[model samples]
Target: MYLVMRKCDDGFRWLETDLGLDNLDLFVADGVLVGHLAWWSAPQRANVSTGDGAISCETSEIFPSRGICREKTKRGVAPSSPDCAMANLPHGGVLKDLYLRDAHKKDALAEEALRLPAVVLTERQLCDLELILNGGFSPLEGFLNQKDYESVVQSIHLSNGLIWSIPINLDVSSEQIVALGIKTGARIALRDPRDDIPLSILTVEDVYRPNKAKEAELVFGANDPAHPAVSYLHNQTKEFYVGGNVEAIRSPSHYDYVSNRYTPTELRSHFKKLDWTRVVAFQTRNPMHRAHRELTVRAARARKAHLLIHPVVGMTKPGDIDHYTRVRVYQALMPKYPNGMAELSLLPLAMRMGGPREAIWHALIRKNHGVTHFIIGRDHAGPGKNSQGKDFYGPYEAQELVEKYKDEIGVEIVPFQMVTYCPDSDEYMPIDEVPKGTTTLDISGTELRRRLRLGLPIPAWFSYPEVVAVLRQAYPPRLQQGFTVFITGLHASGKNSVAHALQVSLNQQGTRPVSLLLGETIRSELSSELGFSKRERDINVQRIAFVAGELTKAGAAVVASMVAPYEEAREQARSTVEKFGGFYLVHVATPLEECEKHDREGIYKRARAGKISGFTGIDDPYEVPKRPNLVVDWSKQSVSQIVHEVVLMLEQDGYLGSS
Candidate 1:
């Protein structure tokens, strides 16, 4: 049985006795073929007869193959190219951006047509969807399923041998799958978590639990928590992986910076209109300073290419400057670049900080956007340090890796030229180019943060005044901002006493709104239906975190006391609350015997009498905090003394008064 695959646009027609290398099992692209070939671009069916061994397709004119080398099936989206990709480099036949054409725009489903079951997207998932629809991840129609994910993670290659370093799949909790009653072959809608709008439909292809440890080691190069990506894999992601192709019914609706968030097709069109054929792209999570501006301009001039100032506005490192602030900084710094030399755009990618692998992944992404060159700095995409207090990757590892695959990646790697300010010359010069005897001045990132916290003057030579002003506005001195004080201990372990006393004290001072989330009150109101099971307890803690977060964002000083017995749950609470303000975890390390004896409610008596099920200190376990800001044992001290210690912590952390 012979399978025939034919394309006519560029007189490309070749079919062997059977299919081979590609996932389609019918088409081969290994460059070693012993198959008979034929030119099948004839006008009519009778023109090429059975004797000539040619098969006719339904369409009158078949175009050149311009898409992922997929498993060619009878029913699939027809291969087509976008106008924006017409000027693609010869070697990189990157598939066209899917969002460019008029047809795909019509694929959005009406609200009335959407089914009952929908998965509300998280911030990270939203970032992924934006890229898939915008064609930043070209040739990937949807999230990866089991086959694709295993291949991508284990080998950094798709089943068809495409280099894809990271696994980008939609994850859901096992509870969610059961709640939705999802089956093997069901169509589910992906909804925006922010607004609940139906964005796309995913046809289920596989449902399986992944080996998370394996994934952490293979994909992130470490299973340690010091790596941000590894921590996210264990803490943020759910249990099950759902895989399927997406039919984009609508792009994500955004209310902020609409103009700056450009898709590949839009950028490609703009470049075409500007007559910018050779473009160099710069990617950053931080605000652009004077040195960065100088480096990028010099790189573009060196390559004779126009500049694209593309910054990631999606989730970056945990504690990164909020995108709203960074975008403002970017806008302010734009005028510093030579006029007509640069254009600004935003990339909504949740960075993995994979160092070397991520650097290559970034290059491939830029190549898809019609960029001919990309800038790679020392330790590109590096995620700080490991638990051993050592850099995860070598300084030049990213540059070296990208250069190793330069030919296949299609984008030229531009090593970052470290520019240092020279007082004598009054100009920025490369570090190596400077005279040996010349003195150089520099400021570290930690130093910059210290300066911002204290409202110190930032040197104009280091950054533009406009950028510094914007940063100062976002990171106001810690004394004027909001913060959270989370206290956890066993039941009736003086947690409530301390929290209530702390609340009253802060209110007496009355500099900020003092809010309290006590355990009993929340259980009666927010979590009345929840039991003492581990899952239910976790849910209760999260509910408290949500309320605390909103209050903290409004410049309030929030004090929460609960039986947050799990280390993981407490960590989650910290992550949620810290996004808006300071989060200080205080473990009431009162000994179990002391806590039981100090209980005035007779709760310990009931637990010993077997009336209370799943008692925390009796049957269930309590994970001790290895490092809490303060550990108060009222048995050895007074409640007044404990409260005094807590207040001191607040004052020292720059939340109470000017530090």
Candidate 2:
């Protein structure tokens, strides 16, 4: 008779044995003869085989071997490797003898259950096992009844780093076992159960856990107290501490900006000690500019509040300027601020652009940071659209949302109108303040970037030359440098034609370019798993932007033609390009009637006949440009004529070589 045993971390140990005996006689004292058991005590030392061989025990500091004598002396203790105790077992044949003492033969027959090795279980499985073990069912009975025992065992082995046993009849090779382990999410350590010999090893899978501290260190400097996220967390913890929120005591150390220590709670607390009667927090994604400075200074002076210039230092919308670069810009402009009246702090927050919801969240967070008042600019907390490709909320919606909760949230919401410069007064004024009929400068950040890329000068009154220079230095060259041309208009507005025409002209001019026709190309190119909803449209636009940014970065000009009607989607596209190259807003201004007449694709016809829902210009709203760099009237101009004008515009903007 032969018995099989598994190798343990210490050495070879008995697991499931094939030794046979009658149940009643095996339990009776001195009643029956059990089968011969030839198992290696230390798998590393002995070889198991049908043929006889002399076994020798060799002990060394480096590697120890087990023999019959050692096994007899160390009855149940497993052999240990010099390094790791859980060293894998060796494979191949080993020889040993099974002997039973004459006086203990009956006891050995009754103690057959003790020969089984303990099985390791995972948390979930352990819970199941406990249920069974606590008078629910016998272990052997439960094991036989279980349907998912193998999968459960595999899960346990994978999570807690345990070895598994393969049946001898399976004829499975070490490589096959390893493959199975990997497929089952368990790591494989190749070794023979009979001998502690290692062959190969592999890890099962990668686990992802968010490392907040490491993220903080990377975004903020290793020890920066002024990091807005750190400061906000610290201030929050301190305020909570006064309220006897014991959880605040467990707050982690902040990345200190000043003393360069991992812990900046002391510095943050010191900054909070200032007795500020009125605290005004300025929220911005971009660095300080002349207009921003004017706004903050004026607001501070008017309310007699201490200005807290808080800039978001977290993951912003893709293609927006990097927070680090923005921070450096702020540092450069700090000296220009009035002393004692202004204070600067970094706030690390992932902006959801929830528009109204975001505004409310921002105010609540500021309240936690001990801010009494917050500046709610146009389009606060605004993520552009809903699932239907419609503007979910307006620019003022965020302000109103915050205002609705202000009294309950304990934060004052100050709404600021859009600020623009008055060339006549040589002073900054809100858009409403300017005379009704007076032509507004009307340039947007997108247009500003486009002009800057074209080597055009931005007005000194709108932005400081120094600041503009910094921006130019940070951004790539516009025009000749590959950038995104976002064309937006109604269906049948010649968006695709204009894009193709631009592409053909660019290619003829020896420029490699790619044209992204949203409806025709992108819709089909995206995975079928994506649904056709407003959210899906937004995602499609984002995907297009990402691809365009990639192409632009690789020096290929991109002509992206999409009906990106919503302001937020367009803004996201503009931002994505601004990160790497310039972004141009080309509004294909074709009249609704003209677009309907040119509905060669029959889309507008279908839309008007109630065959289509949420069609732009028919049912859905197309956000007309608040400000576009170049407006092409597709209704009047032919595709060729439009292409020619665009090329000339590009040439004048320095996007193309001199013709």
Candidate 3:
């Protein structure tokens, strides 16, 4: 007989009056049965007792939270409650979408049975009770025939579907069990099957229990952000943690970061309520300096819009200053902003350094956050270099690409030229405005850093001394020592060979240089999982650029050979590296026919046979170097001859010295 134990609060009164078995010495062999039964729906109490009828037993009990259970009588005579009302206990609702069997109801019920005051079984003890119970014997017969009381307790705790059961030997301390329940976030309760009484229930508390959808419904109402539910659900994905023992919450997107608990719909409503006719978004990884501030202030004033200074507060490339510090710097400058025109919010976005693609993603994200205009600077998502030590994309490419997607993305792309001071004009002017004839008083961030490190004064016209001091404090001089030599050309255009030759030559000349060969190095250094798609290739190039920047910081000259066919990718690389060390473009001008002839690897030959698509020269368009610092024609020169020319170019550019 499968005797199921159910706990209810109503069983205590019935057992005390109808059965008259409350005070009987209820002993079965060496074990005794004890019950602290109470009614399920009504408040009627019964005390622990040993009944004396056909068996003899002794009972001992203790209650710390409430001292000793008391027998209480109501309405003069004993309360005659219906058994059906008392015994018909409702099961907890079925849990849906059970990812694991361990989360099933049967398992929950088995765990619940162990905490009963009358039983008190450990997980091991519960298993033994199942064996005895399945043998089809009465409680007294089972006890007499059972191997040991401890074994019985262990059996019951392990039994499937057994919600509660009486245990022979209650060895586990209530404190220990309660502590376990608390730690595991599981519910604990004491229950009696015969009396249908439940006592001292404990339940697990939900951590991420906030009603996000409901909150969103209340806040957003009808005005929901685009792909609202999908966006929130995507944010709910988690990462494996604690040796895959548990999952941890992922950082939310930029939209979710500012809105906090409010749903996307509610956030939209909140945005609509604001008297913001025009919303301009400024995207930045660094704190605003004078030039940056000036640019944004002017842009905001021009459009008569409110400036939303949304700074990225997510993972960035290595060696970048922490986001917290950048945010603090912005806070210090907040007071200087015109009243009621500027707003600041942290945007949580993982930087792809994707140059063009990144620019598009940034604009779309700002649009989702209710911004109408987005600032797109040169080289927006620009990652430095590929594992093979090659630049993936150009700086200006990001801006141009974003412009292409502007109408589709539904956000205005604000283009701005590089801001610099013109000494002849005695005023700050965009780089484009500076006359070619006038001596350009251009100072790079790298040069400024070097000057500050050497205790030299930075010209006040170029930047505020306070800003220079802050930059110095943030980045010391030693970290600003490297430069990148970016090589661009078609595949098999002697780009990689020339880069390698340059490395060998630089080393022979007593210079320790790092060389990044785009294709070869990427296959070896980065994870094999990363493929060679246009996007991946772009990412690889950015990573290479980042590494080159680091090497430059270490005072090492970096030689990188990459098929940077696009002008935009090169521009971005130049902008990024020139910010710290310096950038020089070396165009290896090998004609399509000559490049195909030297395609010893048969890459070009395969393209001719239609075996490959997007072949740099044959199939895809290869943008020729419009203006490069040094251009080498492989058709007109030998490998050694080209190497000598490279050395000459480096010496002329101040990368090397004349002997």
Candidate 4:
């Protein structure tokens, strides 16, 4: 389900899903509750209001496009001329939030009054819905049904023949569908998985399992999980896809950078109000450096267009710079742009990282925002590495594809020439434009990341000091503050012993507070009531992760030892703990025979005699970690030996001092 919700020139949008909830509430999508709104708790709000108050949202997944219908539209130009299209090219179909906001105003309390049965959303689904509602994914009124899904996957075009690369489908597990008792005609409420407050209502149309191999081969050009999108496909994505039209109650709520977030309609109006007739958009998911500045400025000057520094605030590649850090960098670099030459805005578009096709998709989106041109760079939106340790797309592949579809895409494609700073001249120039034998300075993204991790200086020639400062703040040196030592193994695998020994060893260092969440202790203290059902087990693991994460965030060293048998559960724990600091996963890969031999309590004997059901080592599977930071077999090595190795790991990673 895709719905309409976005920040605008006027107000905040929130669809209240429950009467039991107060002013400030959380969002739930895909079993994960994310983001909390303080604005609601605070008296002052962002914009236009219903009778009670202007609702401010704190959302992890923010959404879609808005109002450009009032502006004139022209081919290869801003909508300024008298003979331009009658209704903002209406071909770029977007539902205006203004309409929903107005309608809600008439019935101020209507949204909260109509209580619907809610369906929780995943993070990806939240991103998809936001774009759909905002018209960033224009011409798409809803998630892809079977026809459109197949057409887009097989041909990189929507069923309507529009060149669309990514398939936007609402996937759910068969278990989820059955649990909800969903049917083809059901009208279900879509809520955030973070804190399950409803965001939209979907009238289900089609439920189908897609052709996974075909989708992977055609759309991603690879079927390996090493590709982030492909990994998401196999791991995070569910079995069934639900397609239908959505009635978005409100935009996904966000609590950060409220001023810079604008709807497409708001942007178009801003451009119109400023008489920005020739607008060129530069889309980025990374911090803009001097080279970036040179390239964008040159592109704008060439077309005599105003610059719109539009960066994505939605989901990007997994390990890329966070939006908060990048946004601060953009703000610091704003004054460097020639006054009145550029404006900065955030886009809520979830990139598929489809490279070539994504470039076309991005260009089409800019056109819908009423821009005359878009800057297309090398490997635009490229998903970094394949399993073979090579780029998924050729360096110039995006530019080539966009060039082929430039006219049809409507936005003029501004090719990004490699801009580098010359040491002798002390000026930036396109790589091809430099005189013969001119020395140039450059820092590749990978190199920058490597240097940043080591706290090395990023020279002025490569980036602005302000931008570098922002990056450094976000990515401090590895030797600083906090970390999590997550030890996972079979039920009787000496993980508890290792955890206690590690805690003692860390304490001996006399550095930071060390917390230990050993298995039996946690089971007794935190999860006394929870049984061994899959859901209960996962919950127990998550609780341990939560406690450990909070401690880690507060700059404490935490050692968590758990059975954590499920791969999904372990990954979830790691994701949670790492947000605060370094997460080292140690697998106690001691053999099952060894664990049973060390049982001592006759627990394994009971399981073998069928006195106990669903025993982990006997009936339930223990998914061995494919790649853990350290693996210790207690059957061979002593606890002291394993502890030494773990401390060595900490020393190597700069968590522990070599002294």
Relative to the true structure, how large is the alpha-carbon lDDT of every model? 0.77, 0.51, 0.50, 0.74
Ranking by lDDT: 1, 4, 2, 3
Please say which candidate is ahead in TM-score: 2 or 3: 2
**lDDT-superior candidate, 2 or 3:** 2
Off-target runs (Cα >4 Å) in candidate 3 are 1-274, 386-390, 476-659
- lDDT tens per residue, model 3, 10-129: 221122222223232111110112121222334333332212121111122222122222213211211221111110011111101111111223344444545533333332223222
Looking at model 3, which ten-residue stretch has the lowest summed lDDT?
240-249
TM of each candidate vs. truth: 0.82, 0.40, 0.35, 0.78
- Give the per-residue lDDT digits (tens) of candidate 4, residues 420-534: 8888989999888999988887888889977887788889888889988888888866665579989999878999899999999999987788988887788899899999999
Candidate 2's clash total is 32
lDDT (Cα, 0-100) at 152 in candidate 2? 23
Best candidate, TM-score-wise?
Answer: 1
TM-score for predicted model 3 compared with the true structure: 0.35
Off by over 4 Å in 4: 1-115, 173-186, 192-198, 204-208, 489-494, 532-539, 564-580, 587-626, 631-641
Per-residue alpha-carbon lDDT of candidate 2 for residues 196-247, written as tens digits (9 for 90 to 100): 3221222323212223344234322232333333343333211100000000
After superposition, candidate 1 runs with Cα above 4 Å error: 1-94, 100-120, 145-151, 172-188, 203-215, 234-244, 490-492, 589-598, 618-623
lDDT per residue for candidate 1 within 111-152, as digits (tens), equals 432655889999999898878766687657678899889998
Whichever of 1 and 4 has more TM-score, that candidate is: 1
Backbone clashes in model 1: 4
Ranked candidates, highest TM-score first? 1, 4, 2, 3
